[model samples]
Target: MARSLDLACRCAQLADELKAKDIIVLDLTRVTPEFDYFIIATGNSRRQLHAIAEEADTLMEKSGSARIGIEGYDSNAWILQDYGDVVLHAFDPASREMYDLERLWADATRVDWQAYLAEHA
Candidate 1:
């Protein structure tokens, strides 16, 4: 559990490093059985979104998390990288607002990922 949380928070940090905005880390432990955490971020453009996704893929790999799959890369609106326990959603600003994942997954716990990084790092 701690390992997964660390991976999730590190992925969120990756998005932040790439200048992704409105980054969120949602703990889905009790909310869903499908995954453990959802790391979502809003990118201003397609390039930025791709950068976040790409970096996340690399980070997850180094964390010993094999990516299960990916989606919406060509769409240039949202890119999803699914690890078994952690999933990342990199979205364009408009796409993020349209999806409103925060509201959609309101039941999940919103993790203060930045604080986690500061304290843990």
Candidate 2:
């Protein structure tokens, strides 16, 4: 697999480690050239969201995917981390429902990250 896709699935796996809810990775390769995947997860609370983001950032960087930037850390609604090819979004329930990214990017293929994680493990 491409490194980008691996990172994306790893992000999903990490999110699952932190007990994130409704985790999904959207394969955006066909949707746009801007990025390869989007790992979207809903945290139970702000602290959980922060933990998920921080851990993901550390893990990605340690794996050589330096973070380009992070946004919405101050907010309890959503936190977005950009690692060039892969972007992970940690959102609270309300914000996730409000944004409805899956519906917005309906064309993007939904990845079976859990299966990938199991195989990798």
Candidate 3:
């Protein structure tokens, strides 16, 4: 599989496996010069947020993708895992509402879940 597709699949799988709510995939390749995609999701609580982050890390590692860094795991209000091409953001509802990364990056293309999966699959 293509690297980008594989990354997207892995991300979708992680989100589903962890029961991430309101999962959104942002195509940041054009919007941001840094990463290709941003996988953003909300967790019910801090514990779930931490679990999502850790699971994403494990999935990335198993897929042979190196984790660049992780931030905000201690509080779990927002946990960020950098995986070079893709960045995973796991947030509790409060933090999600507070930060509103989705609205912040609204100008970027919001990925169509079906299209994304089909293209990546």
Can you give the TM-score per candidate against the true fold?
Answer: 0.96, 0.96, 0.87
Instruction: Candidate 2: give the clashing pairs.
Output: none
How does each model score on lDDT? 0.91, 0.93, 0.80
Two-way lDDT contest, 2 vs 3, winner: 2
Which stretches of candidate 3 lie above 4 Å from their native place? Answer: 118-121
Candidate 3 per-residue lDDT over residues 33-117, each given as its tens digit = 8888888888998888888887887888888888998889888589888988888988888988998988898877877655666
lDDT of 1 at 59: 87
For model 1, give the 10-residue run with minimal summed lDDT. Answer: 57-66
Q: How accurate is candidate 3 locally (lDDT)?
A: 0.80
| Steric collisions counted per model | 0, 0, 0
Order of models, best TM-score first:
1, 2, 3
Candidate numbers sorted by lDDT from highest down: 2, 1, 3
lDDT of 1 by residue, 21-96 (tens): 8899999999999999999999988889888988888888887898999999898799988998899999888889
| Candidate 1 C-alpha RMSD relative to the actual structure | 0.8
